[model samples]
Target: MQPTKRFDAIIVGARCAGAAAAMLMARQGMRVLALERGAYGSDTLSTHALMRGAVLLLARWGVLQRLVEAGTPAIRRVTFHYGAEAIPVDLSPGDGVDALYAPRRALLDSALVDAAWEAGAEIRHHHTVTALRHDQTGRVAGVVALDEAGREHAIAADLVVGADGAGSAVARLAGANVQEEAGHAATCLFGYFRGLPDTGTHWHYAPGAGAGRIPTNAGRHVVFVSVPQARFKAELRGDRLAALRRMLREDFPDLAETLGDARPDGELLAFAGRKGFLRQAAGPGWALIGDAGYFKDPITAHGITDALRDAALLADVATEGTPAAFVRFATRRDDLSLPLFRVTDEIAGYAWTLEEAKALHLKLNGAMKREFAALTAEVVS
Candidate 1:
């Protein structure tokens, strides 16, 4: 059925990136439609740690307060443990941010969706985009979607955005090229635990495995253990939780000890494959944001921040629908993303000795400094 309604933009995926883009464009008084394949306020797989950059963007979007109100605590320090040595880095919060946060995805994504609605974006949950609608000249016109009732809707828009995730349907429909990819390296298992004793985030790294403890809401901490693919396969053969316990005890005894009194709040979630890809960000009347356009291994815990940053960047130029604007957006996204992508790929490989890990850690810090410096320079220019 041909729909009578059209929007300035139709964004697929109502999660962090899509909602942020919708909110930004609607703030400019553009009519926007956001579609999600899942229910509103539901959760997805995430480490749930918010870096300073993401926190800054949330504050700018006026949604950080909502997350804080949702019971997310402030994280002030990040500690990296390499065997007996502990390196702690204190985060200096300025501007509107007092500290970092790792809110549950339910809280964080729901807040962003609310912000999008408040900005006048129409959001439809449980609606999946099945195909892209194209013009005779071969430009993307919009999307064909399926609602909860299994009814088909022909939603037309000036631009279509694929924020659906790494395996993005919009990208497939738009024929976006995979500019680069870092193949799978490691796997991760994570869960929330009650009685975890910390307000800050901690990371312990060993030769082929690593663990992260990040404090989140409701006095629960999100803990994850990452191992090389080989170890992950050998260990996760049967009884997954028991396998995780064994991995932690054998490779990360200190982290295992820290969880002695804590019990898991739910089943442990496993992510056995990790890859990073950079796809074409914009082409014709279609553009991509978040994971659809760029993805990095989660070992660096930069996914959320990168999504937020690119949403803002893409929103600034995408509404125009000009080829020049799309190229500009793609350029800026690459400039901001490539450095961290390289660093994350290296770290996610999990192929380093203790001394090598320490060296790479320092290198990562340097790369972060350079990235921020470039961003600052861009703002000045």
Candidate 2:
């Protein structure tokens, strides 16, 4: 069936990466369509932490102030606890970014979708892409999606971008193979609590276990604990809240004390983790971004940041509208992502000692620094 309408690009997910890509591409005068399988402004499971690179990109795109106005707390310092020792790092202001934020996914994703809409990208929420449409040359040219009413629509575009996340239908249909996969994964359980004292961001680490507290919207702090996936399946069954409490009390007693009488505001959430992967980033006429293309363990809390960064990178090259440009986009993304990926995989293993974890964090920090530098250069040039 022939498409009734055509666009320069059709983005499969309109959350972070897809909306940002649509906004940037629309800003460059391309006709863009962004489709979301979920309702607009809906929330997803997330750590809700944004690193400096993400903050910088949001600022550059003129959306950071919206988050600030919406009451997301500014994170200026982060305390890393290795066993009994605590190391505090003050985020230095530079390149027009003073602080980072941890906005709820509902807010952040909505903000980006709003930005895309304002930039003239057509956003269709509640639309699920069912398959890719290829031209006579056998290159992807559009998508067949089902609307909320279960009506099917065929929409054509010059490019189809899969921002649909880890289990991306676009990746599957396009046969975007996994180029690399991590051997380790970690399971996490988290909940939000009100009345927890504001503590910028706190990361607690003990042998084979980790926990953290991040202040977010509505006077709430998201507190979480992570353990090896094997341990989570084998030992942390039955009462999940009890298991979380036990993990926090044993590995992060101070955070447990900080919780005090402040009970969780919502049901506890769990991420039954999967091994991270680097998928084939771009194909003939389809490209992948965000967790659709590259995913690392959430233990590092950098997924949102990586998504925003790649959105900018892909948008920059996508204007060229050539397969080779997409290749370059993939290459540049891998250059900045591989180190962080390796370090995050190791940390997710939960096989490191206190000293070893600290060293791994240092390596992670160095990789983040390089990513920041690359983004800075992109902004400059």
Candidate 3:
């Protein structure tokens, strides 16, 4: 087929990773196009916590400042409770910078898309990629997409980035074997709370197998409970929200009580996926970023941070004379993601234990506080 069209890059999925990647490349003078199935300013049931490291990356992108001005605030400390014992980690205010800042996902993602658009990357919203086209040599040369009106169209590019998130079609198209780890059927229930008990926007890690609350801006908080598939079924039986709400009251009363007063400000969210990965993050002319590559349990609240990191590294590596930029991007991702894998693995193991839970909770609480402080200061989450 003739070259459909050409540009420096065509980005699929305009969330944080895609938008940031598009922005970075565009700022460097490349013509970039970003396609997002989701609307620019819509809300999502996302666990929008950014670790300190991810927080720092956002600052460099210029959107961080906008978020702050929009009333997004820093979250300094994380507290843990196990067996009536409380472990509070000091997330002191910015000694000049706070390590972590919390914002709603709608606001966060919208800001990112706006930044990409402002940087000169054209965005096609409500467009869904239907298929990917590979050249005879097997490089991803273009994508076949359906716009909001369902018209099929082809767009070619030097590179096609798949930031389409967990259920990424690009990863599959690139021959990356996506697999869910065995025995990893962890079901999650989460949502934002508007009115909570006088809880100081501090993340709360409760006693039990696993229960927690992450605070965010504008009186928004994310509360969730992770349970085995069997337990999840047993608890929900159908009324998942009721089961989840009951879980909070009984197993994590402190958080439950706070949320009990909380009005559901957004959709109640559910996450049912293995802490999974794509065996290969790229091939030929294509690459995967963010949740499209490595996605772990929300237990560590690493989603946003990981997305920012993925975007930053992609900017430097996915550039000129690099046929292997995609591979390099994947490699850099592996290097960064491996540690996170280990950390999440440990957290998962510890979360399943009732006896060792307290010690592990305290240890993690301390780490989160420090990390959170560092995040607000634009250090790293």
Q: Which segments of candidate 1 are over 4 A away from where they belong?
A: 370-381
Residue-wise lDDT of candidate 3 within 300-352, one digit each (tens)? 67777777777766776666528576566677667656555555556664344
What is the overall TM-score of model 3 with all chains considered together?
Answer: 0.87
**Tens digit of lDDT per residue, candidate 2, span 258-351?**
8876778767889999899999989899999999999999999999999998899899888798878988899998999999999999999999
| lDDT of model number 3 | 0.70
lDDT of 3 at 339: 53
Q: Give Cα-based local distance difference scores for all models.
A: 0.85, 0.92, 0.70
Better of 1 and 2 by TM-score: 2
> Against the true structure, candidate 1 has what lDDT?
0.85
RMSD of model 2 against the true structure: 1.2
The TM-score ranking, best first, is 2, 1, 3
lDDT of 3 at 134: 74
Q: Looking at model 1, report the run of 10 residues with the lowest lDDT sum.
A: 372-381
What TM-score would each prediction reach against the true structure?
Answer: 0.96, 0.98, 0.87
Collision count for each candidate, in order: 0, 0, 16
Identify the candidate with maximal lDDT: 2
- Which residue window of length 10 is worst by lDDT in model 3? 372-381
User: Which sections of candidate 3 miss by over 4 Å?
Assistant: 1-4, 92-96, 178-183, 197-208, 238-241, 349-351, 358-381
lDDT of 2: 0.92
